[model samples]
Target chain A: MYTTWWPPITLSHSRRDQLLRALLWSCASVAGLMLVCIVAFLILESAPALSHPGWRRFFTDAAWHPTEDAYALWPMLAGTLLSTGGAVLLAAPLGIGTAVFCQWYAPAWLAVPCRRLIELLAGIPSVVFGFWGLVALVPLINQWQPPGASLLAGICILTMMILPTTSLLAQASLAQADPDALRAAAALGFGRWGTLRRVVLPSCAAGLLTAGLLAASRALGETMAVLMVCGNVVQLPSSLFDPVRTLTANMALEIPYAAGRHRSVLFVSGLLLLLLVISLVGSATWVRRALRHV
Target chain B: MNAGRAWIPLLLVLAATAGCGDSPDARQPLTKLSITGSSTMAPLIAAIGKRFERRHPGVRIDVQTGGSSRGVADTRSGLAHIGMVSRALRALEQRDLVGTPVARDGIGLIVHNTNPVGALTPRQVVALYTGGMTTWRPVSGKDASVVVVNKAEGRATLELFLKYFHLTNAEIRADVIIGDNEQGIKFVAGNPHAIGYVSNGAAEYALRHEVPIKRLPLTTASAPPAAGHPAPSPLARPLTLVTTRRPPALAQAFIAFAASSHVHDLVAAHYFVPLAA
Candidate 1:
């Protein structure tokens, strides 16, 4: 049984196998080590701002005037959460629905092309989306509202940018549903809609949740498109039409010119974004684990 | 296994060859000069550097842009042979480094071309920025809410704008916080009711390229513009090159070239006012 298709286990082959394993192990360790180093560096750089006597102001202060010693983080933090939340709320349902449509209902030709188009949407660089939003979407919104670059614009752009991620992941998850279960449902006289509602969706709950969470994280970390479309005012928005700035956008906008304590504060903002993304991923893992248990 | 083993040595050899080309020989010494700081002055300095390089085949001028503070830090730390600062050295900066004026630039308020407001007094400008005047109608423009665009902290233009207006960063009630002069100009040009202040040179260059934004004259109560002639920019600053107290001979030569009449055309081409001979 062992000798039928196996290549002769020569010394050179064994040595090469060991070498490949070693190479892969080193690569994996290097990636892990780099992540640790990045976390350490962020903590070190942000220590100044974190340890400052007036650090409490970061949560309480109304504005982000770092030069004036106001290190308010709430507004930008709120901006990040709100825009990403809005994007996820809008994109998840539409994306999952698109996936369901393509997987079950659409004709083969239409499904293939539609899937490819959504994947294509993922490939278009965020900067292009940002440019389009600025030149096209912002003005369109401005016609109805006074200022175009608002939280609403940011959310719309993020939704477009993250839709591909959610849809593609959902399609993959839908593809993972048991064929036997589908056949059983069909044998029991279940229609497409009934089969989808009772069997397809429940089986793919973990994957759908994972898809939504991944998209949320992507939206949270998005910088260029959000920076361009979001008016980048360091204030909590009073309305959807009001301009807002996110933590990521704030760092990108300031890091080029930031120095001294100002630079440290930007690092703190990075650390905050990292924590937010981690919590999202943690929740995703917890949900997946709970789903597996059930 | 054979193919994998064959590829390893080939990759090693390729990496070795790639590393070998960059090592300099002692015979033909390459004199590399690093110039850093001031994104505002980078284009002008880079243009001058190109002309300087053409004259000396052995020399390379590497121009980098951070902000003006990086210019001072790098010059003092000897990381850069020269640093381009868009403003005159402050008393603190002057203690460790010397700055030579190469050109002049003015910071001025810019608004969309369609905006009817012609000029803003110092008080009116302050009021608009501090949320005192929220609407353009008060400033003689159409009945629309004005969008005040402010620059982020650590920008030289922001510092100059704040200093000239006699306001602090905390005072500004900005609707949009932009990063650079180009961003400010582009933002103003895109929004009919938006007003932003940026480098006069940049705004002039933008106007030449048909970016629909106009610079408003800086007016004060003591003096008004004579008929036909607009008030000269009140927030003018020198664009200077900074070096340590004792710079190398090559650095001195480059500085002289940057300031001399030879590169005045280059300075003017960048829309900065060339220093009078």
Candidate 2:
């Protein structure tokens, strides 16, 4: 290989490979260092709250009166779970169904446009979605139900915001399904529906689940749209109609004004969110591994 | 070579962290002042700065906004010549810094004009906020559930409200939490059943603009008696300009300009009650 294509003025192949390896290693380490730094910084800043209220009380007690020294975060935690779970529950099925239609049912002309449209929806800024939700969807909800700005509105907005990503990921996964299996299924005289149901989907279960988890993460981290529509109420919502505040919303809304232990507690909330998202992604990986083994 | 390479990143991180401190070049002969902090005070400071700048042609005044804490931090660290804080300084902060009150503002409870209730006792207000009183029927004689609008965390308005009512930040059961005065007022304007609070200046402006919300006065008898304060008004607080040490000459001048009768019209124009007047 060297005899065929040695450059006149270049380092030895071994030296070149070593240099490239070093460069890549440094770049990767820098990125990993940044992640470690962020997590460490959050933990350091939140240490006071963690030690004072202690983790159990931080997780268990519902009241969050930082000024008065009570630091329970249960209400915001519940809000985060409820809204994100609601969004995922609504968006996942619709997103996967759209992907299926695009993969199998939609003609080429329709499919391309549909995918492009979904990408366009994804491109619109979250703040614009928040504004639209605030100005239009909120009032409409209010008219339908008294005091319309609610968890239901937040869920609806989040579903629309997250749908594009979920569907696009699902489509990519479905497209990557084995052609050999599809052809074999057809050869076995299985119809399109039977082949899709029996062969294509099971192989794509991990991918579809990943898409759902990614969508759920987006929903969980969402601040602006939910903040605008969710009413930012600090309560365990009894119904979708009830207003609720997510952790992200609480942080964004209060970070500027918070100081002392109150400030540390907010950082603790950040650590909680980081831990929650990491575990969620970890579970997705675990599920994928379990599926592959099966 | 290997040791030198390892030292490079360590040096870079050190440099980045230490970069914020002022360099010798920053203390040039030019008469420049940088003021940062409380977003609520930012507008007022900006206005005064413009007038001060015009009065002293060669002098430049730079203003920035984060929050009152940023103001205190900036002042303590010498990042700014002066910090603009809307709220009174805490005991810890007062140790290292001196605050000169510039203006006063009151937080007022507001409700939609469509609601028949004109006034709420302090106890009723606390009860309504704490989720104890859920419906308007028991308190206001209106057959509607109370939609308690609240301030987002970190707002001076929210802090002031909480302190006045003898409540903590978390205890208030809010239906909607809004960021700024305009958002709070707009929420109340839109929903007849909603109740919220904002600075008196903002409330007055909203009322003048016919936003369809009314400011409810706390009955004087039930209002928390003024204690350990120069002005015993439960709802009123001073907007203070702070400095870490004895302020520099330029900072002192700026503080004077902000406090004096020169900016009285400007302060009143922004809805603050002028201290001198």
Question: B251 in model 1: Cα distance from truth in Å?
Answer: 1.2
What tens digits encode model 1's per-residue C-alpha lDDT throughout A24-134?
Answer: 789999999998999999999999888882458789877788877778899999999999999999999999999999999999999999999999999999999998987
User: All models: lDDT?
Assistant: 0.87, 0.84
Tell me the docking grade of candidate 1.
medium
DockQ of 2: 0.41
Quote the positional error of residue B270 for candidate 1 in Å: 1.1
* Top-scoring candidate (lDDT): 1
* Candidate 1, B143-249: lDDT as tens digits: 88888888877788888888988999888888888888887787777888888999877887898899999888866634564453233467878999999898877
Q: Quote model 1's TM-score for chain B.
A: 0.85
Query: Which regions in candidate 1 have their CA more than 4 angstroms from the true location?
Result: A1-13, B1-30, B220-232
